[model samples]
Target chain A: MTAKTTDRDRDWAAALAAANAGDARAYARFLHAVMPVLRGVIRARGRSFGPDQQEDILQEVLLAIHAKRHTWDPAAPVAPWLYAIARYKVVDAFRRRGAAVHLPIEDFAEGLAAPEADPTAARDSAALIGQLDPRSAEIVRAVSLAGESTAEVGARMEMSEGAVRVALHRAIQRMARFAKGERG
Target chain B: MRTEDLIAELAASGPAAPALTPRGTGLRMLAAVALAAGLFLMLAGTRADLAARLAEPLILTKTLLPAMLAAIALPLGLRMMRPGARIGRAALWFALPASLAVLLWAATFARTAPAVRFADVTAFALSECVGLIIAIAALPMVFALRLMRAGAATRPRLAGALTGLGIAGLAATGYSLFCTQDNPLFYLTWYGAAIAAVSAAAAALGARWLAF
Candidate 1:
């Protein structure tokens, strides 16, 4: 690997290790840092997808990374672990749409420097939230869409911050399940 | 929702528990084997001459073949649990024990007189052997699938098949102790059939359960 790639992997690995140790800021930083790489890879692979469809796939990748984070070994390099999930989600999106595509592993390395952009519009994931219980839907929307902190949402909902976090985690997990075509 | 918003939500969800290590997977697999052993002993004790028979090369081969298969498949199945991890050369390793068994079967079949070859193959309790092997495998297959589900398997069907193959190998090992049928012609056909059935079932189930 290149020196730059080594540095990026080291940073991501450390951040993810800290994130797993309960540092939310580190986790956020890790997610932000990886977003451009993930976006670039997704865009390159799913060129036929509209902007919204691409975002939907990106959101699915993000949710999968969250839900399956426990599958990543701390001692291993973060890039492969991260990109594996990205590739799986991208391939899954293609399969769901009745298309078959073969993505070369090297494609991910080239897309690492691609620019990140906001989704043109909310789509599948936005609709998935409505399937959550009313309280969970509110908690997810308040925290994600309105940019409210867990503490703020907890206070407004008369729940503990810890409870809010648990609820949000469960809600996100359910959304992941829903996205994968699982029923309640 | 915007990508940034999704990132915020995931970040706030807090850290996940540590990934399940290879050692953890090994321990769970051992526990499943223990459970299968318990079931095997309860339902069908070892053959009367098992202690003496174990010293015989043919008797030992029956047990060792599946045992070896399980040993190799455990790591391969664990690799399948990871999203992008390639099983690489470990997958090719399966051919070692597999070819050994097939060659042994072919040699044994050829040496037997053609007239009696059919009798030798059908001499055992075919239904009982197949049923017992599957029965021994059933619970362990569930445990293996559960463990597979806990990880992010990108190739769910393949992961499931590997797990099933491993579990069936263990189950077959246990069944070998109870099975007195020493003929390679008999054990090879029925045992192979049972393992294939289990693998296929797991592959179908994994496609549905391990998708995430």
Candidate 2:
């Protein structure tokens, strides 16, 4: 099924149809009209592709459209079909390079998952735990903020592993309630 | 090359494209088939006992099955010559007549004694028939390839192979007229091989020559 055509798309279709009918000027105009938009399509895939790669893909799309111009259905809108070829060429270039540029999961994790020692978060945690008694605050900070194992916190606090885990769970539940209360 | 230069070069040509007439292509293909048939008749001649063989259904099927394959494949090959047009699942219909021919071959083998089956498949015409069909196919294949070049084929190799199949079918039909073998097995094996050989050769050539 075809999408609704815009005035811009109709202009392209008319030019291409005219070009098919032996109008050289119209064919040149059609090529000129599409080049910028085709460049934009390739550019919009982001900077993972270098300038040379983008140019290569753009030339490929233009060549394909030119070579296969007769195959385009004159009744259909031109823009989508042309962009589809550009997209395919871009993808082909990416595949040919063996690997695509991608931001790794760790990059996003660093951006979104605030580190334990983030100053603002650490201050907030300190304020929240300040409400606790000295022993509870020490246990919460060692096990949660400081990223210590339960057994290590247990040994440091002179308690069993099970006891340390219970205390850590209660500390998290209390911190959650306190935060929700502060938000409310 | 720069897009501007490419555009200028393409537009500089007298016409954007030739008047692609599918009917004209179909006629040329038929003419090529006829020419190949005439050549085959001149070289190998038609089978003797022509009236008696025509009376037999199996013999008639052996002679005409390859023609049926051509009838089916020719239209598809012409359609595929157009860029962006696909053979699609509809091309699978080519196998229907082919499968029927294979079934006939199976029945022939089942009904005949093993010793006779061996003799029938190994007849003097067995190998010669393949050679004759390929010989007859050469002209039609060239015609089909030239016709293919007139259209912009996206998948040149596939289009070339399809044209080869159609042309080979026509060639096999011509060869069948001269092929005297009564056993379906011989026609099925040798004819199928000749068509495949042509298709493979055309596909290889198309890869090098058919792209727009």
Candidate 3:
């Protein structure tokens, strides 16, 4: 079990390192790999939450991880950092809903072995995206939901690919901020 | 949105800018200190005896104490910026300088004649001393908060308080050069009050601004 955990950590760390070095495909793989762990952890700790609420927390955690990616240290194991962020967001969600719970670090280890569950569409994130300006919202929808490339989205929108990418990035950041209750 | 779709979008967002290193944090802090020092010098010129006063223990303590606190707080604040980072014994390290300040104050309080002790505590520009420290710290506090915002501080209030403590230390250190009050009682009261005020303000601000 220890060896398996070590191997998982090594792979996740390597993928995240690659992602930091600008490998998009590796980044996608890393995110996909961590999703189950995050979902399990959230579900375990947030038992009071309904499935939709759990997923909302999951999505918020994912957005936070993306926005704060620079806080991760490549030299350190990814698990602690990943679990810390997940725990923080989970605790935050609970706090916002006016409840308190304890989540020991041991729970994260158990979360690793949790059964994989399909993700449902989350409402909060969708609402945040809807709150974004029209152009940014359209670009985000095209790129993520439609799975279109930046180049494709840009061509359709009559903007440069770089412009599309920047818009999308800013939109994601704005959504994260909105999730945290920031205005403008 | 589906988690899978969200992951696809995040992955497509491209690589983040490089993670900030301890060295980078140090450099930015240094820049903020240098700017604050420049402002301090311009507004309140250094005392003429500044060179000679360095040899005096009390005069030196005034500067060294805050400098020590700043040194401790800079790294502590930085560590708090990372997610899941345990503060451990680092939090305890603050006691060293704090104890030193209290010791110095006690020693001076004991030696001074009772008739002069009260006068000593209130002898100088009490409001100005605190006002100057806060003013000096204003820019650095903003800079520190910006740096904290760039990182992911889970304990935003504590992190903000640390930043305030660190910036106040640096500001007080710079202020000591221009401040002519040498009484340990006066410096300790006003300087301590000023640092506390800055830290409290930072704590309040951090609770709001440092979220996420």
Candidate 1 vs candidate 3, lDDT winner: 3
Better of 2 and 3 by TM-score: 3
DockQ for every model comes to 0.54, 0.18, 0.57
Maximum-DockQ candidate? 3
Which ranges in model 1 have alpha carbons more than 4 Å from their true place? Answer: A98-184, B121-124
- The native-contact fraction of candidate 3 is 0.85
lDDT tens digits, residue span B10-42, model 2? 666655665466668888988987898887798
Residue pairs with colliding backbones in model 1 are: none
After superposing candidate 3 on the true structure, give the runs of residues whose Cα lies further than 4 Å from its correct spot. A98-184, B121-124
lDDT of 1 at B87: 87
DockQ, candidate no. 1: 0.54
Ranking by TM-score: 1, 3, 2
In the order shown, what is each candidate's alpha-carbon RMSD? 10.3, 19.2, 10.7
Candidate 2 ranges with C-alpha deviation above 4 Å: A6-11, A40-49, A67-184, B1-14
True contacts kept of each: 0.88, 0.32, 0.85
Worst 10 residues of 3 chain A by lDDT: A98-107
Candidate 1, residues B70-149, lDDT tens digits: the string is: 88877788788887878887778988998998899999988988877667455348887888899889888988888777
Residue A49's lDDT within candidate 2 is 55
